[model samples]
Target: MTNPVLVEVVRSGFVESVHRGALVITAPDGSVRFFAGDVERPVYPRSSNKPLQAVGMLRAGLTIGDKELALGCGSHNGEPGHVEGALSMLARTGLTEDALACPPAFPLHEPSMLAVAAAGKRRAAMNCSGKHAAMLSTCAQLGWSTTDYVAANHPLQELIRATIADLTCEPIETVGVDGCGAPLFAFSLTGLARSFGRLVTAIGGPERRVADAVRAYPWQVAGTGREDTVLMRNVDGLLSKGGAEGVHSFALPDGTALALKIDDGAARARLPLLLATLRHLGIDPGDEAEALAHNVVLGGGKPVGELRVTAGLFG
Candidate 1:
């Protein structure tokens, strides 16, 4: 059982593509609400595991500021605000962008690039740089070597692996390379959800600062156009994180966890499905649901093309 959802792209009256995947929702008490396909099949958690990684950083005695905490869990858009925040984090620890291990790239938000270019900068401004920077800073704090920080054999990686295993309550049996060249682990969707649940639970138990930081600076945790930040903004006492290739996770303040993996990586369907699942679990997102349901891009405060979800898979 690979993907249970039928994904098709029919544009201009022709089916252009198709995909498959699964989604699972669970209650706070570990009861399943809805499940499709192999919900328990192991998969790479990807960037969705950032918040949980932040928990490891916290437990390692990293007293990061709210902004750093957010960066630890973020896939930031590399906007000026994001770069400034990352630089501030490095500055606080007597480090610089040169200390980061992530490859240089550009901002995820197009608007941010204009601002960054206008400032006469040479750095690529990639969003994930902040996460890499946080990793470097944590390694620095822990007396670990900055060289080979991204290597799977690094001490930091060992700590991260141990932390993830502890949170998921499942030993990692597979490892893959991530976009930033870091090692990614394979775990079931349920294991990822349970990992997040444990992270939320840990935040309340002696690691309250990590939770406080994520909640206090949700924007830095993802970016302006990211679902994690939007969901966090819309829901009270809930934290959300999105991963590459259509992976996502959300945790209720009380430890309820929801995780999803969209086989095709059609990001448009991710939030809507999550919203529907959350609603089924008694979560209300108000007007945010509209934004989640449709894409209304505004250039000059007027309507333009919209990104719509046309999936009939639920029916």
Candidate 2:
């Protein structure tokens, strides 16, 4: 069945736009508790899959400290701290940033990027640099080639693929190139949610270790004032990650997970949908809706309208 229209862009007292999407909520046992939209179709989960991949690195004997582990699973905002953590991982392994395969980009934070541009530098501040650094470090530690480490068929990538399959409890259907030039696995949203659930609930494996690091260093997961960090900071026993193209996944300590993607890639639609989904699931996350209020509609540089769930859609 087709996914429902999950959000509408209301502007000037009208529904100016619409966003269709899929959502899957799964339990620790990989049971589907609730689903909406095309949850069974396979799609690249983008950076939301970082935690799963990071756990694979952990299982591969990749030893990293607290902040480094967080960065391994982060789409960092290029803050100085994040950059230091990423570069430090490379340095500890006697590697350099030049060894990375991901393309260089400015920091995601506006001020950081502005400062960087003012200094005539667009260095390896891309959000995925930490992940790349960790991947390269893994290869170096294992005596694998740093060259072509980003290749889909590389041994390093093979380990990651197997890890993702194990976490999601399903075989992958396709492989796509992620923005960071690493191979991305295409899997069902149900599988995505289940993967996150498993990560949160792992008994004593690499999954729990990685999840613990991310939860402890929430700032590295995104950045100061970022939604993922804010939500993770406020909500107890929750791990949240968002991806490019509107993909997002979050898990509770009990291993409940929700994964979703907005069809048109409307990132603005995600927070409200998250609020609605949380409320629908009977989880009262105090001040979370306000924490995400930055995405509210505006007119003439002032408060105008607000985005809300369609009446009774989550009821």
Candidate 3:
């Protein structure tokens, strides 16, 4: 069955388009608070899975400070600090950016991208470099081969897969290569929300460590002006992460959690839908989040319309 429309694009009072997707919101008690579409079907959480993977890294003996840990759990915008941070992780392990497995690419941040263009594409500037560097460090520390660390059969990846299963309480349905060449595990939206909830509410251990690091170092988790950075910075006690292909996930200190994936992979639909979900849960999310929710449709370089969640989806 097809997923239902979750967002609509209005252009000058006309419904210009729609985005169909699935979402799940879990209460602190692990009950489904609200959901739309096939919450049970397995879908990739993309970079949204980073926080879970960070926990896995810790469990596997990866040693890094909280700031570095946050960077490891981020799909950063590759600003100067982000690039340097990843490099520092590599430096600690007696390695360099050349050890990274992800393909060289420009920064996700516009100004940084321009700056890096002069040096051409570099692996350190890729958004996933921090995660890759962390994975390599984990391998180096455990005496595993860094040459093929991104392989699904790599010891680090194996541990990560197991960790994801443990936190989500669901076996991975499929494994695919992610954009940055890390192994991607697919699981239900319900499972995704549950994992985030577990991370936030854990009394101790790696889960809480990961959650705390992400919340405390929001800038490292994303970067300037990014959705995850903006949301986490403005919303107290919130852990937010957005991924490739329109995947988004966040958890509150109270263990409430939400996860979603846009069917068409339109990034524009994510924040609006998330804000609407937050409002449904009676969370204000502050003015910055409200402003970011407006995915303006521009005509003649001016705002003529906007993308918004379909009315009544939350009700």
Candidate 4:
């Protein structure tokens, strides 16, 4: 394993917390150009792994438009559009929210959570609803069992697992349940970056379809003002997705890929670290990085300090 990178430091007038993590950048041909911290070890990619899973469903014969595809690959903000999209996916499959294996939960977006709670809606509005709905529809299309779709040993899950393996070009290490109840694999950070590279640079096929949907409907993939949304919308030919426990992944049109994880699970550190990583990659995010700095430290509701990448991150 390589040495860990000092990716970020939190400050409230002074250094408050430090985040140590690894980053792996791979070319389309699977050559590692930059390696930081333990890329050889397995990390739970969380929702950053969804695009590969979405393309997996595509190969499994799931049929839908760009909207559904975008939502299928998203960690949505649980906005009304997101909920409607999830419900619509279910509607097309002749199923209901009752079939979803994920426990009922509120929206990830605060305002939408308030509205959804007031309306007494739960499961269908959850952030993972679209992915759940996608899995259900894939089962419907493939004649697989929808009951216990989230189970680790389900045939549907096996296929999804195979897809991850196929894209990463590596065997699975271990399996665990995602926050949304779907079975997820422990994948190496280098493998994660390579898989994302494969997805974004894929030719005209299911992979391209997933990538195109993400680029075309960036909002559906996240939501208004969200980091992924902002980055995809404003940055040319950039694809970004963030996952729980401080996992972040992005890819370029040319198949440049980067995957990073914060050891402390600080979401605030992910973007700043990402911007610095991008700088190392020679891509300038320009004003978009500045615009997405909403995670600043607040003192009495006024901005006091900032979360930023530590110097010499690549050291």
Candidate 5:
């Protein structure tokens, strides 16, 4: 694969992180709709891989009765509503905080963590704990041990890796430790996009449950102040999932899959670039859509500065 050009940004007269990567858009029939540089290069699809992990839970005999299913696939904010839903998931399987495999901590976002602490709880406040809880429940149903479930060599990790490879139609070339310290698999942008495309098109199959869950509880997928949740909720039949660092993906109902990665791992540029790319591709996100595509800031509750991305980059 040819190396993608090193796109650079300058701030204060110094070059910064080369926010460079590729994206792929494919159709239901597996035809490429769009392609960009170095799309074949490998990447570790982080939290963006959540939906597929939920698929493994289903395959392991996890009967995720609607609500549990939604919470399982969500990268939820530790909001009261989201936590309540996650707790209900644990309740259904007669499991509790002690059963979760993910480490104990507060939500990733400060505001959400404050909200969670105000509610007088700690365990449920952990964002990925919901996913860990679902995994534990699945392990129980499968008669497997919950201990070391997050370890790379654990059966859960193996299942997750296998499932990701299966969906992406690529071999797992390497594994890395994710932010939550779980195993992360590497695959090409094309492969990642292909996996998501399949997920969206498989709306009537078993995968449909995940799609339904994300669509139904878009708010739970992320929370207030999160772009993934906002994008999904606002876009009709479009699912948005964000990974740690710079990974993000979106799939439209029309069978278009898009994936992107920012090399510098700058959280700020990700969503803005994604929103812009989707728009350039003719995906209309109507009403205040420019707010997403362009970087506009408020100073003391009033508009102040605007960050304008170059349009030529898209072409």
Candidate 6:
């Protein structure tokens, strides 16, 4: 079935466009509270899988502290701190930036990207470098092969697969390569929400560790002015992560969880839909979130329209 329209673009009081997608929300008891569109279909969670991967790394003997662990579960903006953190992670493993399997890329943060433009793109500056470095560190500690840690059959990847299955309560429907070169596991949006619910509600073990790190070091997760960083900073006891191709997920300390994917991969639609879902759960993330949700569309450098969640979409 086709996905339902979840967001609308209003220009001069008229609907100019719409974004279609699927979303699922789970209650504190792990029951589906609300859902729209094809929540059962499997789709790539992309970097939304990072937190689960971090849990897998910890289970496989990764010993990084909270800050480093946060980075491991993040898709950072490649700011100075992010690059330095990835380097530090690699150094601790007796490896270097050269060991990262993710391709060289500029920072996602525009200022940082421009500042380092003269230095050229480096693998360490790629957003996924921290994740790759963490994988290498796990391999180093376990005496596994670092050269092909991103390989699907690699020990680290195998462990991560098991970890995801365990938390999501669903077998992975497909295996794919992530944007960062690591193995990607595809599962239903409902399963994704279920996993986040598990992460937030876990009292102990690697799941709690991953969730704690993401909450404690929100900056490490996404860098300055990013949505995940902003939301986590303002909302107490919240773990938020956004992935490539318009995937986003979050969970509150109460085990309230949400997962979403924009059908057309328009990143602009994500926050609006997210805010609508949060409202459905009686959450108010305040001014910054409001600003993000009501994203302005420009015409000749002036605001002419805005993106908004479709009226009653969540109801």
Candidate 1 local Cα displacement, residue 42, angstroms: 1.5
Writing each residue's lDDT as its tens digit, candidate 4 over 48-148 gives 99898898889888988888899988988889899899998989889988998877888878898887677775887778888999999999877888997
* Clashing residue pairs found in predicted model 4: none
lDDT, residue 199, model 6: 93
Candidate 1 vs candidate 6: the TM-score winner is 6
The residue ranges of model 5 lying beyond 4 angstroms of the native Cα positions read: 1-18, 108-112, 115-121, 287-294, 297-305
Which of the numbered candidates is closest to the native, going by highest lDDT? 3
Model 1 residue runs over 4 Å out of place are 1-3, 6-19, 31-33, 118-124, 206-208, 293-315
lDDT for 158 in candidate 2 is: 93
Q: What TM-score against the true fold does each predicted structure earn?
A: 0.85, 0.96, 0.97, 0.94, 0.86, 0.97
Prediction 6 global C-alpha lDDT: 0.90
Question: Can you list the residue pairs that collide in candidate 6?
Answer: none
Q: Select the stronger candidate by lDDT from 1 and 4.
A: 4
True-structure lDDT of candidate 3: 0.91
Candidate 5 lDDT over residue span 1-315, tens digit each:
434423445444344445665656677665677666677778887888888888877766787666667677777777777778777777767787766656567776677777666555466767776677788778767877777777888887788888888888889989988766567889887787777778778857657778777877777788776777777777888877888777888788766888877676665667667776678767766555445544544558765554444446655
| Cα-based lDDT at residue 29, candidate 5 | 63
Query: Taking the tens digit of each residue's C-alpha lDDT, what string does model 3 give over 1-315?
Result: 334647889999999998989898999876888888888899999999999999999999988899999999999999999999999999998999899989999998999999768888899888999899899999999999999999999989999999999999999999999999999999988999999999999999999999999999999988998888888888889989899898899998899999999999998898888988888887888888878776799999999998988777866
Residue 99, candidate 6: Cα error in Å is 0.4
Off by over 4 Å in 3: 1-5
True-structure lDDT of candidate 5 = 0.72
> Is candidate 4 or 6 superior in lDDT?
6
What does the lDDT read for residue 110 in candidate 6?
A: 98
Comparing candidate 1 with candidate 2, which one achieves the higher lDDT? 2
- Residue by residue across 1-315, what tens digits does model 2's lDDT show? 644746877777888778888888897788998887899889889999999989888888887887888988999899888888888899988998888888888888988888788665443588998899999899889888998999999988999999999888889999999988999999999999999988888887899988888999999989977888887888888888999998999998999899999888878888788767777776766685456645568899986776766666754
Error of 3 at 237 (Å): 0.5
